[model samples]
Target chain A: MKKLWLLLLYGLLLTISSISLAEEESAFNWQFGVGLGVSHNRNLLPAMDSPRNGIPQLQLLFDFEYKNWFAETPSLRSGQLFGVRSGRLLDDFTLGYRLSNSERHNLALIMASYHDGFGYSVASGDGISSSKLEGLHNRESDFMPGLRYQFYTTDNQLLSLQVNKDITTHHGDMLRLFYGFRFEQHNWDLYFNSELSWYSAKLVNYYYGVTAAEVRSGRPQYQSGSGWRWHNGLVGVYPLNKHWITELGAGINWYTQAFTDSPLTRNNPEVVSFVLIRYVF
Target chain B: MFFRYRLLLLAASLFWQPAQAEALLSASPSNCVTLQQGRECHAQIQTAWTISQPLTVCLYLDEQQLQCWHNTASAQWQWHFKDMQSRQLILWQMTDSEQKLHVLATARIEVSWVQSAHKKRLWRRF
Candidate 1:
């Protein structure tokens, strides 16, 4: 398995080069992009109450970009054998429905998965072996819905507030609200420049907080309850002269599942980092 | 009856591959699987490419060359091992021109001996 990881890194490099070949045209319309990224959960299983550990993750993001998609970027690092990273979009899609006079009300739905390549979140140390690495039960997913008032702050930036919920058969599920500032001056480029998010338990437990009873019975180990997690990320995209894009991002999420734990727990909360590449068509 | 039960136990083994498949040189699955004990196993490689670059695919079950491929399309790589018995770490690799690598994915399937026919039917199906 260790040797296999090295080869996959080669494939990732190819994916990056392919991005430079993306179609170029700028306009205010509908566009679709597919992104593949790897992330790690700095925090470990809640039961461990230790500092957050790491879970290497992979994901697919689909954005409905409004207008032309032309942002490009230079290639970044050719990830390490056990490289752990995370981040958001390079170029994302937005939806706009005209409302009132010149004001447009926008709505966007987002679906993302944390392919916990590691299997489970155990802060302990290296897993059982370099071979099995981690189990598949550790991977998870999330969905988000937001209401936007573009031009609310100015014609170039928008005020965005959103609520997102994560779902995992036995990992983490939480609700978080985002208050963000965006830079959307170009059809091909934009930035949710920065944002602050608050996560409530009523939101997170729906995903991460499973029980021993469920596992013992062979029933699914997902307990839909209330819990909280907190984290914030910056989304930026640089469109290169060619079609490729460089996505630079950083985020830190804290899971409160730590403070409250029984023998059955998911993980402690902490911060993590994200550095990824994107290719859109 | 006991020996027959042991026979069924020997039949359980996870998928294993040989390193030769690494020759495939592009992200994809395994071609040849190495069974540590010659047990029944199933494995295959699936490739996806965003580039026109011909990919080289390879599979490694205990550093042995189980499978190898030199395809010219990124999405043209794939492999699988079927009904084999073995217990070895399986490694699948794909390499490109830049020498960079993508961790396409990995998995571990362990075969164990069981005493009940009832348990056999429940655990043997993936």
Candidate 2:
């Protein structure tokens, strides 16, 4: 219900902005297509092998700007999470107010989105209940409000930093930094983004910590502390013609000690990758 | 990149006309060029005309008119580019004796460069 109201409110704001700005030549732009993707990730329980699945993929590239205010979702290549079977209707949704854009750098106040928490009930028939990680409460999705800065460097390199705190609840506070290198030649474009993400203790604990009431036989109580994750990815886009492009990308996340110590986490390095062919209209 | 492509299409739309009275203009391949310092590119501009009257066609780089020709039929020009230090909007204009200048087509060329990353910056949206 809250999410619905938020969506309606955002629509109303956009309509109001559109009506107020009659002289400016601003339009809402969007690009969309469909493809197929596959990803492999560790199971929620320890001692279990990684699970891989294929899924239908959806690609969306959208941007709407009114004066200094803008809402944009660059691409699925950036910091995105892909599921094996399930899918995301949208990628990273960022609404921001540009403070200034000079030759060297750009600054803005941004509100960014974080993925939902993961929790599932365990059945006795299923194996690998080794450390007892059942009955854990689920954590809701987080919307983080924060500030971001981007610096353009020589040789087509970019550095970005973002710090945000969850608005839905104070459970999570995050700091993310990225260094990206972009290259373009002929009809091919490639980008490599290396990122480091810091999760506050409260945030990590809420998602991975074990609670007393949920504790059961052989499931000892566990408390997770603050940790960091290293995420790196590469995305390449090749034009097949005037209107079609083939996109392929792969990303992996390396868990920190605190995160791996959690009874729910299995793999140290989780892998996510995708491939798509899209036509622009 | 998307903005550059969109601008090229918008420039083409300005010259759209009916089949009977077509005054169409088009650039072969694309109209936007991005190059590093001391680099250059080439493009060919072609025009379609139905009336047999003489018309003046001019090509403008930034605000300066580079060349002009008086022709009775369709006209095509080979463009050679060099020494572009910044982004430039190139325009092709068509004018009759009545003193009306019409922008028949347009293109953009930009010198590729990147700023040093040592500068301070901050921005966010959510």
What lDDT is obtained when candidate 2 is compared to the true structure?
A: 0.56
Candidate 1: stretches off by over 4 Å: A1-28, A32-62, A65-104, A107-152, A155-157, A163-175, A182-206, A210-225, A257-269, B1-126
The CA lDDT at A92 in model 2 is 57
The fnat of each candidate, in order, is 0.00, 0.00
In candidate 2, position A147 carries an lDDT of 89
Instruction: Give lDDT: candidate 2, residue A93.
Output: 55
- DockQ scores of the candidates: 0.01, 0.03
Query: A202-280, model 1: which lDDT tens digit per residue?
Result: 3434334444533543233554435444545555554431234445454555544432352233344443344444444
Tens digits of per-residue lDDT for model 2, A30-106: 23334344433343334333232343445554455665666665444223323111333443556787798766687
TM-score of chain B of each: 0.30, 0.41
For model 2, residues B25-89, the per-residue Cα lDDT tens digits are: 44443342322223233334342222344566666666766666676446666555443343343
lDDT of 1 at B44: 52
**Candidate 1 CA-lDDT value:** 0.35
**Model 2 spans > 4 angstroms off:** A20-22, A26-52, A77-91, A121-134, B1-126
Error of 1 at B76 (Å): 51
